[model samples]
Target: MALNGCSIWGCAKALQPATSTLSLNSKHDLGKCGKWRRCCSSVVNGVESSFQYADRVQVQITELDDGFHKDLNMLPKPLTANKFSSSRDGTKLCVAYKGLAGAYTEEAALKAYPKCETVPCDDFETSLQAVESGLVDKAVLPIESSEGGSIHHNYDLLLDHKLHIVGEVQLLINHCLLGLTGATKENLKFVLSHPQALVQCEMMLTDLAVTNIGVDDTAAAAKAVSLDGRRNIGAIASSRAAKLYGLHILAEGIQDDDNITRCLILARDPILPETNGSYKTSIVFSLQEGPGVLMKALEVFGLRNINLSKIESRPVKRYPVRLRDDSKYESIKYFDNLFYIDFEASMTNPNAQHALESLQEYTTFIRVLGCYPVDKTDISC
Candidate 1:
């Protein structure tokens, strides 16, 4: 049960199952059924083989902890020479972020765990892999921006990865325009940053008559501009990026609006739920083709008095198209969608549990992404 630097494997015990018998008297066949058949498969080299293992098994619940660096093979990439280490000795939690120290992702990670050691990655996926592989105890990934709404890619990544959401942080975004020394706003001909940052500062860049060039990360963009040493290039990034890259700030708060990006803290294991705190439960579900199916699913929460803060849908990956009959001869095609909902109740709440149970009755597939405490930080600029 010790999760300290260990993986939580499924705890199961096999029980020799009993044979079945049925009666044919109106409702069943009398003493006709035999032992149930079961087989487990395994692949050796490239060949496959099957063997009967267990008929009955049991599973147990497990919680997350910082001691998870023992599973290097779980990493998305091969283990490298550089292993993640705590900034201090080996006591602090090793956290991962998608950018260098100046990136807002790093700020979010720090805000969530002020004393944790933060490691930077080239991209979001690397940070996620770091957590999954036990390179870091946790990862901070931005899920939504106040201006641009939900980051769809992050939402998809949530489904693609098995990592659990353990916490959340809302970081206020105040983007700054940074350029190399002696570079003025008027002289800047191109603005570079992540696509979202570029879009957020669209009007400002247009007014400055600078072409916005989308790049990987805002911090990386700033670093590029600084290294390029071009007066014609400015970067829309954070103030910290400017200082770290030794770039001059041409303008402050250049974003079209004051934004708050909501980040999800990811880990290999789920956090132990607390009953008496303000909490939110996030879930994704898919329903079969039928009228009022979605309505029936939402009604479970309403019936249970569970308030939903957000509900968004994305097209199901494999089967994106769904056909609908508009008329006898005409048909309409729509995307088969998977709904992600955030309800204002913890999973520990009986009402929330009942609501999800009711929801599953109508959904073909459903998953609870997380049930974590609500972030009440004054995330105002």
Candidate 2:
């Protein structure tokens, strides 16, 4: 049955957290007769009180005549807090990271949650979707690099997904040149890596005078080189990738600069951070075009003594171009933009609430992406 635009399971509502831990109690009717029903669950101190969302993907097709019944299994599920607990806490956490098993993103996840179960995904969206679909408890995806700049694709995905940012990790990246055991750097005719990695190691690649090819990710490139068994081709990836794929590390720290990647930890629910600890909040907003309009919106934070950590603008995809008419001139066309901001404060802070309230008066749209604790661990490779 065609179920496009169908609002099944009460619009597939995102689970709302009621306390420091989530204790959801939502019920939705199934089919026309409502005979086929499933009991929704609540999480108390990381334990499931009812149905286990992760292991219930199978549904009987006979119930499809009701339309909503057949499609109910497609809705996203929430992760229990227990699955996020650390090994030290005596609970095993299942976390997802982009790329192969040995990717730098996996290192970041292990650093943040020691002994946690790491699941590998082919791309960033897959990692996020895993967390949303109850396949994993959290996803650690790179958002920015110290030398290569912001990962713009992940920023756009953060806007599209309903997952919340629960934490972050900044890992000092050490890129390595990998090749076959018998391969040498002097004999290599070509190198492969992600676009950002290739750019970061431009000087080194130029010194070798080899053609550089861009791939989906660093670890994937390393895996390809290992499987291809080409003596003249090498890959730029993490040292861990070399070990995982059984490739030789021809060169260590190939990237010209000491690059560090900042990764964000996403989950279905936000953590209740302590008021005494340092926190950061991320928000996205849009404003009407006019003189001093942008200035007026920024003034809210400035006047309240709240510090903004980052600000970026992206063209609105749905309505990229719009016409503006001035009383003194003819109508002019311009691209509409959505502004993303990261600030230093928690949502529980009074000043932050007032700042957002004040900002609402001037903005056409505003959303609080997440309020998460800042990662302050001193990192070393």
Candidate 3:
């Protein structure tokens, strides 16, 4: 049972998408079986193998065996284009996004998967549901915005759904003020857009001396003006939305800064990235309550030289507050939390595998969200 200088490989074969629960009996050491691999990857014997997975993880264990090979049931699968409705030619692929045809989500989808068909949904949840149900090959939704910060809801939604983070698309947002052909800034009375968009362009809206109105979406804002035949109400949307809705670009790039929204591409299955390329693994873990426990958990990565990219702590809503007594049963409280971390490492590397093994020993629960190619989008714009 000693892990001082030895590593054990408890390899779980790549599973079909049905069973996502990963089981690792405590009897085995960290390297034995960490979790699930994808279609092309698995840990064989003590050999660390390359895997492609639509990353997502759970569960308990029984006791000791040197070469234990109990099925961990790391439920995962790869996204195949077969999920899309076959056209007469059956060649073009389709992806889903929220909002109208010209909305930025759709733009990100098309930009990431050029020549693929882009389908629109009424809201963000629908896009995720569509991907989960295989109604579309993939779905794209924004996770973070540079100027305003993270979209907290999407982070929560990532846990609510079972889709994998197959890819990432970072789009430079350039907000355009759209209006009826005859409408000008001076004549505009009200400006409408998604609340976030409105916030992003608050200064510009104020400078125009126009009233700001928050609506469902920027594209819808443009659509409303077009349908109403209104000249006074303009929309803060994209130039593409302006063209699609038959509006003029009253102003362009009005956002507070060169804003960027990092969008996640979700598919039923995870894609396997190159073994040697820059990659990131996202995981969520709950830890035991004790001083230095978190530091001990984090040290695993540091020991292996696996750099962490992002670490987010979300309050555990179900157990938001834990009651403690001062040995006198007086009221004392503590916050229960879950840590979501993103680290730079390919799971195929032995060092990365060892790190997870060490983490398994230190944390109460851990789940791998996905291991994906790092988005190296040049930020010069």
Candidate 4:
């Protein structure tokens, strides 16, 4: 692979697709399974389709360059001008989400914007790019899950693009164990689904004592299991996926716990939230190397009585490692990370303005990801 530009796709070149069957280690009929299947129908036309094709070409990604414009220009011409369907008039909102029609991301997208036209994307980057290129009005991103923790890749993607986080939606996941029409738990040998879903259903799968295989998307997993036509091969997905792929639900609500996935809404332009409304502002910042650097940065918020809902740190992509040398100790290396915080206060609040102003003194770099109204609606149903 050649290191050309900063785009993750540009850093590598495509190799020929492998024709060999993927082997699974299990006591059951693992040898009967074939190669992994990609769901191309999930893709739309235009640049996103080009991105999907490009993603297939390259598997390994190296250091990403600073710009995505050069990579965007390398793609082939779009199949059609209107990538989304024509039936959706200009009045309707078009939103992009990663994975097949029955995937959880699509569910979250619809929950956030009920009437929006949901566009299925092959990958997270494609979904983000779709919004960046004006192919869709907004893109819904799964940021954190109550069961599996944070989706770190999307946090990096947030910094990579110029898009703004406009809002958020939380979805209660109800994972189901699905199989062929006549397939049952006793005959099933292995279960397949997204890695997160697999983890969520760990206890249930362990009880069944079947081999677990991780796929890209839950809906795609259901589709693959249905397409494989093997009674032994089952999938852990949503009830909707079972219906969509013509698979039978062997078990329902099979998740180990009550899991909730919080998805972020992204747009090309930022939304101005009303000051009086309940809002949560998200910001990312890097502090100078010091013992109390992070603590001091947080003190500003605490002083203003601004409640922080969440805080997470991600390693700086470009500068991951930093050398630390102190007079008392030998030279050491530490991960240089950027902290992401979600505070329960609107950006329009005067207290928030003062907090941020005070925060600037302690931070080397800072950027507000978004300030949007909180999604307090009960969506557990």
Estimated TM-score for each candidate: 0.72, 0.73, 0.74, 0.74
Worst 10 residues of 3 by lDDT: 42-51
What lDDT would candidate 2 get against the real structure?
A: 0.68
Compose the digit string of candidate 1's lDDT tens values, residues 176-288.
99987778999888777888888888898888887777766787677667556568888888887777666778999888778998999988777667768898878776674
Worst 10 residues of 4 by lDDT: 8-17
Question: Stretches of candidate 1 above 4 Å error?
Answer: 1-90, 321-334
Positional deviation of residue 191's Cα in model 3 after best superposition, in angstroms: 0.5
Clashing pairs in 2: none
Worst 10 residues of 1 by lDDT: 37-46
Q: Rank the candidates by lDDT, best first.
A: 4, 2, 1, 3
Candidate 3 Cα errors over 4 Å, as ranges: 1-91, 321-334
Instruction: RMSD for all candidates, in order, please.
Output: 15.9, 16.2, 17.2, 17.1
Error of 1 at 276 (Å): 1.2
Tens digits of per-residue lDDT for model 4, 1-381: 122211111101011111212221222222232221111000122121222342333222122233312222232222122353334456779888888768888889888888887787767888877877777889989899888789899988876776778889989999999988679988888787888788888898889998887777888677667656679889988877676666788999888899999999998777767758898888777675568888999999999899999999987655455555465664544566778999998877778877877786666556667778899989665
**Which residue pairs collide in model 4, if any?**
6-65, 14-57
Comparison by TM-score, 1 against 3, better one: 3
Best by lDDT: 4
lDDT at residue 145 of model 4 (Cα atoms): 88
The reply for model 4, stretches above 4 Å from the true place, is 1-91, 321-333
lDDT of each: 0.67, 0.68, 0.66, 0.70
